[model samples]
Target: MKRSHSNTGANPDVRVRMRRLRWTTFSLVAASYMLAFFHRMAPAAIASDLQLAFDASATALGALAATYFYVYTLMQIPTGILADTLGPRRIVTLGGAIAGVGSLLFGYAVTMTEASIGRMLIGLGVSVAFIALLKINAAWFHDRHFGTMVGLTLVLGNIGSVMAAAPLAWVLQFTTWNTVFIVLGGVSFALAVLTWLFVRDHPGEAGLPSLREMDGHEAHPPHEGHWFEGLMTVLRNRYTWPIFWMNLGIGGSFIAFAGLWAVPYLSDVYGMERVAATQHTSLMLAGFAIGAFSVGVLSDRLGRRRPALISTAFVHLLCWLPLVFALPMSLAMSYSLFLLMGLSAGSFTLSWACVKEVNPHALSGMATSVVNTGVFLGTGILQPLVGWTLDRAGTAQGAAAQYRLGILIFFFCVVVGFVGSLRVRETYCRYIS
Candidate 1:
C-alpha cells in the first residue's frame, strides 16, 4: 500500500506525540464514562433512602430507578447515530453537561416527580457516553487491539460502579445521599469541561495518521452514505439481531439486579444490613470489572469470540440457580456466588465486539448501539416488572418468597441470554463486513 501523506515521513517524535494526545483524549472521555456507571448503579446502595425521601412503594421505587433505563433504552440508537455523525467529542461533552445538570437536580429534588425527571435526564445524558466511547476506541486503536481497549474502558468505567456500591453505603453512614449526588454533579460538570478541551474524535482530527496508517496499513475510510443508511445496513444484517437478544437477556438482567435490587434482595432475603449487603454488590461489580477486562484480552489472544461468550453465559446462568431457589447460603457462599455471577456476567461485554466485528467498520457505533439498546430495554422492563411481581406477591408471602419470585424473572432472562449465546456467530476477532 502506498503510504498516505498523513503517514509518510511520520517520525518517532510525531508518533510519540500522537500516543500522548490519544491517551489524554481517552482519559477525559473515560472519566465521563465512569460517572455514567456510578449513576447507573447508585440506586441500589441508596434504595432505602429513596423510599423514605419520596415515601415511595417498592413499585414506585423500581419505577424511579427504571426511569434511567427507560431513557437509556430510547436513546441508544440516537446516540449511536450522533456518535457517527456529530463525532464522539461533541456528543460526550454535551452528554456530560446534561448528566451534571440531571445529577444536581436529582440531588436537590424534594418530590417524587422531581426525582423521576432528574433520573430520566441522567439516563438521557449518560446514554451517549458508551457508544461515543466505543466509536473513539474503534477510531484510535488498531483493529487487532479493539477488544483489549474496550476491556480497559470497561475496567475503568466499572470503577464508578465499584464506588457506587459498598463505598456509597459506607459514605451514607456520615453523609446524606443528597450531598453525594450534588458532589457527583459537580464532578460531571468538570468532566464536561475537560472533554471539550481535550478530546478529539480520532487522530485525523489532531492532524496525525490513523493507527493503521502508522502500522503500514491503509486507514478505514470514513462513512460515505447518510447516517440512516448506515444504521439500516447494520439493522438489516442477520448477525446483529442475535447480539441484541443476547444483551437483553444477560446485560439487562445484570444491571437490573445490581442497579437497584441486589442490595434489597440481600437485605430482605438474608436479613443483612445495608452496608453488609453493599459489600456483596461491590464484590460483584469488582468481579464484573475484572472479568470484562480479562474476557476482552482473552478473546483477543484466543483469536475467537464464541467459546468464551458461551462458557461465560453458561456459568452465569448456573450461578443464578441458588437465587431462584432461595437456597440457604453461608456468608462465604454468598460472596462467592455474587462474584462468580459477576464474572460470568462479563460475557455480555463480548457482544459489543461481536456486533462491531460482524458489521461494516464505519458503522461500529451504530452496530454496538443497536445491541446496547437491548441491555437497557431489558433492564427497563425487568426492573419494574420485578417490582410489580414483588408488590403483587406482597409481604403476606414474606420477603423471601417475594424476592424469590422477583429473582425468577432474572433467571428467565439468563436462560434467554444463554440461548442467544449459543446462536452467536464466531468472528475470529476481526471485522467480517
Candidate 2:
C-alpha cells in the first residue's frame, strides 16, 4: 500500500507539525467526550431541583438520569458502525450538533416528558463520541499508545464528571440549571465546528501515512466488511464475553454511583449537605480520572492486561463490601472509600484496549463498542433496580435501611463482573496469542 505524506510532501517542518496536529485533534474530540460526561452526571447535581420541578419520585428520578444510558446503551453497536464507516470527523460533528440541541431542550424544559426527551437526545448524540474518539486514537497513534491514550481521553472526559459534581452545585447557586445547560449547548455547537475543521479519520486523509505504516507495519487500513460477519466474529470470540460482563459490572457500578446515586446516598445515609455531598462525590470522580490515566500508562509499560484487570476488579469488589453492608465509618473514611472505589472502577478502561487488541484490526471500533455497551447496560439496569428496591420499602429518597437489598444486588453485579474479569484470556496487548 502507498503511504500518506504531509500536505507539503512530507516537509520536515510540516511532518513535525503533524504530530502537534494529532494532539490538537485529540483535544477537540476529548472536549466532546467531556461534554457527554457532564450530561451523564449532571442529574446527580440537580436531582433535588428536578424533584421539586417535576415532583418526580426516586424511581422516576432514576429513570430520568437513566434515560441517557438507555439510549446510549442501544447506540453502542451502531455507533461503532458509524465510527468505522462514516469516520470520526463526520460522526463527532453530527453528534456534537445533536447534543447541542439536546442540551438546549433539557435546560429549558419544564415537564418531565420534555426533560426526558432532552436527556434521550443528549444520550443519542453523545453516544457517538467516545467510540469515535477511540477510532481516532487507533488510527492516529501507534498501537502501543492505545491504552495510555484511552486512559488519558477518559481523564479529560471525567473532568466533565468532576464539573457535574460540586462545581455544578456551586454554579446552580448563582444561575439556574436551565442557564447552565443552555451555555453547554452553545459550547457543544462550537466544538462541532472545530472538529469538522480539524479532525482527520486517519493520517492518510491528512496527507500523512498511517502510524502503523510509519512504524514499519506497512499495512493498509483494514477494510470494513459485512456488519453481520464482523459482529458475529466478535461475538463468537471467547474473550469478548468476559470483558463485556466485566465492563457491565465495573463500568455500570461506577455510572450508577457517580452518575446518579452517590450524592443522594451521602445525603440520606450520612446527612451531608448538598454541596458537601457532591464534594465527596467529586473526590470519587477525581480518583477515577487520575486512576484511568495512571493505570493505563502502567498497563502499557507492563504489557499485561489480565493481571491489571483482575487486580483492580478484586479491589473494587472488596470496597463494595462496606457499602453493601452499610458499614459505619468516620467522614474521612467514607471519603477515602469513595476515592478508592473510583480508582478501581476506572481500571475498566483497560477492557477497551483489551477488546480492541483481541479483535481484527479493522474492526477495532466495532469491537470497542460491543464491550462499551455493557457499561451503559449495567447502569441502565442497576440504577432503576436501586430506585425500585427503594420504592418497595416505601422510601423514595433511599434511606440507609431501604438501600440494604439494593446494595446486595449491586454487590451481586460486582461479584459477577469480578469473576468474569478473572476468566478473561490474557491478550498481552496484541491481536494474536
Candidate 3:
C-alpha cells in the first residue's frame, strides 16, 4: 500500500514535466503566429510591387490588406470561447492547418477576388493562435509571470514582422510574390502537424501536475460557467470594458498606421525610395519588439501597470501631433519621428496585463480575445477609412495632407485611450495567487 501511494505521488512530478512541455508547445504556437504576421503584413512590404502587378489603386490595395483584419475581428469572440472549451492545443493545431492552406492559396491567387478569399482564410485560421497561447500561459504559469511571458512571446513572434519588412522586400527582388507566399503556406502546414503531435491542453491532462501545485501554489480550478453566461459576465465587468475600449482606441490606430499605411505614407508622401520606406517600416517593427519586451519586464518588476499604461498613451498622443502637423519633413526627420511613433504606439502592450488582471483566472482567454478583437476590428475599419480619406484628397503632392487627416484621427484614438486608462482600477495591487 505504501508503494502504491508512492506511485500515485510520483504523478505530480509527471505533471510538473508537462509544465515545461507547455512552454515548448507555446513556442511553436508563437512561431505559427509569426507566420501569420508574415503573411498578413507581407502585402505592405511588397506594396509597390503588388500595386503595379495588379493595377491596384491605393484604396483598393488598402481594402485588400484589411481583409485579414475583417475576418480576424469576427473570429475573436468565437475563437475565445472555442479556446476555453476545446483547449489551445487542438484549436491552434486546426488553426495552423487552415492558415497554411490560406497562405498557399494566397500565393496562387490570380485575381484580387481570389487573393481576398485567401486573406480571409488566413485570418480565420490564425485568429486562434494568440488567444490560445494566452490561455495556455494563464493556465500553465503563475499569474505573476503572465505579462512578462506574453511580452517575451510577442517579441519572439515579432521576428516574423521584422522578416515581413525588409527581408520580404529582398525576397521579392529574387522571386515573385506568389512564390514567397506558397513557401510560407507550406511551412504553416508543417507547424500545424507539430502542434498536434506535441501540445497538451494542461499539465494535468499530460499526466503532470499544474505549475502552481508543484510550487506549493494553489491551483484555481478552471471556470465552469455556461459559455454564454461566462461571456456575459466578461461583458458586464466594468474593468473589461475599459481595457476593450482602450485597445480599440489606441491599439486600433497604431495597427492601422504601423501595419498597413506607414510604408505608403513614407514612400508616396515623404519621397523615400521603396526600399528606404520598407527599411523605415522595419525600424518601426524593431522598435515595437524592443518596447514590448522592455515594458513587460519593467511592469513585472515594478508590480504596477497604471503608470506604464498612462505614460505610454500620453507619449503616443504627443507623437501623433508631430506626424499630423509637421508635413513633408526631411526623410531623416520623418524616420526619427516614426521611431518615436513605434515606441509610443507600443503602449498598447500593457493591454494584455490589464485584461489578465480584471478577469477570473479561467476567463483570461476570453477577456484577452475580447480586447484584442477591438484592436483588429479597429484596424480593419480604419485602414479603409484612412484610404478613403487619402483617395478623396488624391494627388501625389497632396498625400501628406490626406495622411495628416488620418494622423489626426489617430490622435483622437489616443485621447480616448487615455480616458479609458483613467477609468480602469489599478489591478497590480491585487494578488492573483
For candidate 1, lDDT tens digit of each residue in 190-278?
98888998899988898777777777776787789999999999999999988999999999999999999999999889999998899
Determine which window of 10 residues in candidate 2 has minimal summed lDDT: 1-10
Flag clash pairs in model 2: 4-208, 4-209, 5-207
The residue pairs found clashing in candidate 1 are none
Clashes of 1: 0
Query: What's the candidate order when arranged by decreasing TM-score?
Result: 1, 2, 3
Give lDDT for model 1.
0.91
Worst 10 residues of 1 by lDDT: 1-10
lDDT of 3 by residue, 170-246 (tens): 88788898898888888888999999988877777776655666555566667787988878877888788888878
Q: What's the TM-score of each model vs. the native?
A: 0.98, 0.96, 0.93
**Between the candidate structures 1 and 2, which one is better when assessed by TM-score?**
1
**Candidate 2 lDDT tens digits, 1-433:** 4544333444576558668878888889999999999999999999999999999999999999999999999999999988878899999999999999999999999999999999999999899989999998988888888899999998999999999999999989999999999999999999999999988888778667666655545564466678778878888988888899989988898888788888888888878899989998889998999888887898888988887778888888898999887888888999899899888887688988999988888888889999999999999998888988777887454477887888888888888888888888777776761
Clashing pairs in 3: 14-208, 15-208, 15-209
Q: Rate the local accuracy (lDDT) of all candidates.
A: 0.91, 0.87, 0.79
Query: What TM-score, to 2 decimals, does candidate 3 have?
Result: 0.93
The predicted structure with the larger lDDT, 1 or 2, is: 1
